[model samples]
Target: EYVTPGGYELEKILNRGSVAYTHVNEVWPNVYIGDETAKDKYNLKKLGITHILNAAEGTWNNVDTGAGYYTGMDIVYYGVVAEDITTFDLSQYFFSAAQFIEATLSNPQSKTNKTFN
Candidate 1:
């Protein structure tokens, strides 16, 4: 069984982690988490971006470019149509998205980014 940590324990654990205020961050080699600007075609081309996982799809607080936007660009695209909200449960996309990210980062020449809206 797992001992569930709660209240101040959880807060303490969470507080130990750090986050930055940057629009784009390279968390691992060839792997990136980027905002709209980073996902721009020109920027992506400059960055040599090989794959893009769009976290914000549709029109509501989203990019709405869809996969077709990257056609003929040698960039692979995957989209998760989601709203950026506190109540929007995104757990459903976690596994598949992770798989996609894993596949994207597996190549030596890969420059993968997950676009944030």
Candidate 2:
């Protein structure tokens, strides 16, 4: 799920076999996800975004090239962070919808190590 500042929430639901799954997530006020390359960075920066959180995963060599390029232009690059939340398990955790939403909204630091140039 992705949400913009205007209260527009976009959700992608997946149905697999006997399971239906939806990820509850939200974006910060003006952060953006770029393409597999860096095309979306320009448009996002033009829209006045000062920080970018990338949820993609890989080696630093793979992730930081784009992050470094964007940071060079003065954007605050936050991720290339980890994708898993180890605290919650989808099959066994019986959290209320509100509780689940609250948990998701909490910003936890990534377990992945970040490298700097």
Number of the top lDDT candidate: 1
Locate the minimum summed-lDDT window of 10 residues in model 1.
18-27
Q: Cα lDDT for residue 47, model 1?
A: 83
TM-scores of all predicted structures: 0.76, 0.34
lDDT of 2 at 84: 46
- Residues 20-56 of candidate 2: C-alpha lDDT, one tens digit per residue: 3222111342222343333345544445545444444
As for model 1, its CA RMSD to the true structure in angstroms is 6.1
C-alpha local distance difference test of each model: 0.80, 0.38
Alpha carbon lDDT at 29, candidate 2: 28
What lDDT would candidate 1 get against the real structure? 0.80
